[model samples]
Target: MNKRIDVKEAVLEANRLILHTEDSLSEIKGSMNAKGQMLVDSDQLAFIYLLETDEDFIYAGLPHTIWSKLKEALDKSLPVLLKINDSEVELVQIIDELQYLIDNIKGNANYGEEMETKVTEVFS
Candidate 1:
């Protein structure tokens, strides 16, 4: 019934998330830390997003340090308490990626908005 609508929305949202993550990663890559070093502390990001995987998979977009922590928590069946840093834009991007993961894990088709236009074109 409403599955079509949900899938369409999820696809659009996933695209947005992907774009946001790409932008944030680019911005952060060009930024520096308080010590004038490249922002390399994956243990603590400006913001972090958490999502459970259908499998035991972990989000690979995170820094290895933080990813390890998340993996450890999952392995131990413990809840993760991710740290927060100072990158607001980065935080938003991570959150979007998390939502995208959630949607995909729920079995939503990843056909983006263009798929809808393509379908209309075929029918017309």
Candidate 2:
């Protein structure tokens, strides 16, 4: 009984964490779009993260316009896409590592690395 109770509590905690992370990540993607806009004509991002759900294709984290753009691409019979985003906890660790690499790079401060891995995971 005690073991079962502990397991259930852990599950709840996990769900809570997941929700919080998603919210934070959405914020980051939104922020990046906004900042990029300051430099150029930035378009909202489209995120595709693989998930273990029955439908298997989860699509969310898109702003209204971007999401609208994709709607035309989807056939009427397709499964609904769930938008997941913003994990501040995860973003901090990855961003910190990237920043560390940048700071360590000699002379040129324009060093750039693909944030794709995390991006995939972010949408994932």
Candidate 3:
């Protein structure tokens, strides 16, 4: 049915977005760790907003554990910006996002596997 196809497409897109966000967070963390801090300009903030506001992403049905962790991280990071080293920096958001990715990467036995499994379960 068309509805099922739409759901499948949404799920796939959501998964892609989630993976992209995870990867971006890792890159940001690495940059910050290497440079002691990094600038977060409007483009980066817009990317975060897109992820948060995207309808497919919102309805992705991510597992509660993962969803809660992401929500908490975003909540901590999104509202605060600090001027550091002559740059407008999202220090709190970067730190929170970094910590969330670190915890998920370290804690999971198979980091991305759960997401795949959840998606499969949903489509099954």
In terms of lDDT, which candidate is strongest? 3
- Full-model lDDT, candidate 3: 0.28
Q: What is the TM-score of candidate 2?
A: 0.17
Q: For model 2, where is the 10-residue window of minimal lDDT?
A: 1-10
How well does candidate 2 score on lDDT at residue 103? 38
Q: Please give, for residues 1-124, the per-residue lDDT of candidate 2 as tens digits.
A: 0000000010112222111222323212222211111010113222322222232222223322232222322322222322234221111122233233323432432322223322222322
Better of 2 and 3 by lDDT: 3
Candidate 3 displacement at residue 35 in angstroms: 21
In model 2, what is the error at residue 25, expressed in angstroms?
17
Model 3, TM vs. native = 0.19
Candidate 2: regions farther than 4 A off:
1-43, 60-124
Give the total clashing residue pairs for model 1: 0
TM-score ranking from best candidate downward: 1, 3, 2
10 residues in a row with least lDDT, candidate 3: 1-10
Q: After superposition, how far is residue 30 of candidate 2 from its true place, in Å?
A: 29
lDDT of 2: 0.24
Q: Is candidate 1 or candidate 2 better by lDDT?
A: 1
| Top TM-score model | 1
Give each model's whole-structure lDDT: 0.26, 0.24, 0.28
TM of each candidate vs. truth: 0.21, 0.17, 0.19
For residues 36-88, write the lDDT of model 3, one tens digit per residue: 22221121111121111112222111223333334444444433232213333
